[model samples]
Target: MGRRAVFDDPALRLANNLLDVGRADLHRRIVAALHDSPLEESYVGDVQDQLAAVVTDQRVAERDRREASRLIGIGDDLLAAIGRSGTVLMVWRRSPQQVDHPGQNMPLARYESDGIYQGSWGDIETFESSPELRTLAEALNWAQRRAPHVIVRPWWNDDTHYWAGDGPPPDGMDALPDHHR
Candidate 1:
């Protein structure tokens, strides 16, 4: 048989979904979809560039342009998180109910350890900071105290996780199922 068409690629689906989604819910929808499987650095960069162009294109709708601008911010953050190096710092955003306190959301961070199986990650210590530190940047800086130069990844929102000192992730790690959420 000839080569088969693969129609289930998440990245391709994401792109298609982006085209069909309403402008109002664009950013949140994209974020939720990306949380399932983050795009590669190159793809993220490409999409960001395309969105940037859309933002500046006079032909595009004003609402669409605004939505594109917002997505560019998401792209920038995702790009930064993926580009980090050193230890693997996984940060999770916890809802108020999930935390000891009931007032606000909090950030929880943990480092990835080498698992028993080769090319697998094991869980180690976890740090749950006070609600005062409200942003991912704050959480990352706090977690940095335990391990400097970490490849910070949002745990519940992304699948690619690697240990400190590990160069690029091994093949297929990006395809890991959505287990963190």
Candidate 2:
């Protein structure tokens, strides 16, 4: 009898199917899918790097394998969440040093329909008819109810970089929005 081929594994085949998805589309799909997962802003970079390494090296270290597995699980969850219809509040920061304009960054909060990315202070821009406006407002409400002060500062907890929802924001941050404060 012939030995079983590695490609014969069902899980590997599923992963290969997911891997075949276009990079940008895959990311967008996953973000949209994982609307309710814990937001770990920093994991974005590390997970991308680790997953890349795993794909390139068949003999990757156990740590890389574990991280890749964890990310795959996240992707699976994200895929499962697709079309479920919900919100994911995103927050991010763009420092003046990062952009050409000086003193341009005022507040940092951004989102698509189903994901939230939050970080340091930055310019806030959104279309007048942006559908995510409601989601952003909801996140703000959640932050206020959860953390009455220091509304926008990012922090880390349980090895995840969470902002405004996981816990109280850092000290001295103006709780009110730009116009309000």
Using lDDT, give the best candidate's number: 1
lDDT of 1 by residue, 15-132 (tens): 4555566433443433433321322235456556656665776755777677677666755664232333234344443333356767665554332221111111112211122232
> What is the overall TM-score of model 2 with all chains considered together?
0.22
lDDT string for model 2 (1-181, tens) is 0001111122243334445543343334333332222333433354444355555555544554565565545544332322221222334233223545777764432323324424221111110111222344554553333222323322111123333333344454323334322
Backbone clash total for model 1 is 1
RMSD of each: 17.2, 16.0
Error of 1 at 113 (Å): 20
Cα RMSD for candidate 2? 16.0
Q: Which residue pairs overlap in candidate 2's backbone?
A: 88-114, 88-115, 89-116, 90-116, 90-117, 91-117, 91-118
Winning model by TM-score: 1
Clashing pairs in 1: 87-164
Q: How many residue pairs clash in each candidate?
A: 1, 7
Residue 109 of model 1: what lDDT?
A: 34
